[model samples]
Target: MQVTKTALKRIVLNRLYDHLRTHYSVSLSRATFVNAEPEAHAVDAATAFRSDIEIEELQRALDRIDEGAYGTCIHCNAELPLEDIRKDPCKRICRGCEKFVF
Candidate 1:
């Protein structure tokens, strides 16, 4: 409820766009770069792994949006700051719980 309807819409759109971009990156890295040189392949694999993580986060964000819990931390249930949401709409935990998560 902290975010206005208009802002929620914008956040959703941004998350969706980021999801698409990250998915494409993962696909490209796995397919086209899989047969590259040894060092390049390692880097591409790492990039793809990071992209996979991002894809998961984006999906969770969409799910939380659908459930009307987008701007709240899943860990502590604290209302996430609007600025934090603006920076990373897919964030699931607040800064406080973030330390323990990783």
Candidate 2:
């Protein structure tokens, strides 16, 4: 039996929830090549910035759920298989139409 799209949406929501719970922090480099030494704080800040980008994408995926547009290809406007969406929440292609994307 195949899982319904609504169930997959719940899974996606759970994943996003888990990711939000974990706190990932980046560290800074102390030795600078050009200057006297790189500050450790600089490295940590950069890590946080990268993590922010991930969070932004997560928010976008969540928005798709709210829009009732999850598991559908944005390009072809076709419903992607629930299994595919479950494996990759960010995937935007159905199996048959995926070839065109490449």
Candidate 3:
């Protein structure tokens, strides 16, 4: 199904909220540090770090949506395929640019 700009905006916003919630829940505090076992604390720390990155990226996507740039390839300024956006709403580049960048 072809996703509209509105849908993409909603998806990004939802993802941003979810990531922020998870990050906050997992990040270590003094209480958590005292209570968590070493291995579990380490794992939570790693997960929190990944969630932090995702939150940043998703926030950028929301900014792009507000700026009328969402779903466009950042490198080429082409409209990204709806399928690609549906598959990964946080993706900022099109498949073609993705090949060159990585």
Task: Score residue 101 of candidate 1 by CA lDDT.
Answer: 91
Tens-digit lDDT string for candidate 2 (1-102): 255444554665544444544554323222221122112343224434456655566556656766766777778888877677767777777877878878
**Which candidate number would show the highest lDDT if scored against the true structure?**
3
Give the per-residue lDDT digits (tens) of candidate 1, residues 1-102.
556644654564455444555555433433333233323554335444454666556556655666677788888899888778878877668999999998
Clashes of each: 0, 6, 0
Decreasing TM-score order of the candidates: 3, 2, 1
lDDT order of candidates, top first = 3, 1, 2
Number of the top-ranking candidate, with TM-score as the measure: 3
Evaluate residue 37 in candidate 2 and report its C-alpha lDDT on the 0 to 100 scale: 15
Residues 1-102 of candidate 3: C-alpha lDDT, one tens digit per residue: 356555676666555445545556644344444343323544345345564567667657766776777888889988888778767878879899989999
Off by over 4 Å in 3: 1-4, 25-51
Off by over 4 Å in 1: 18-56
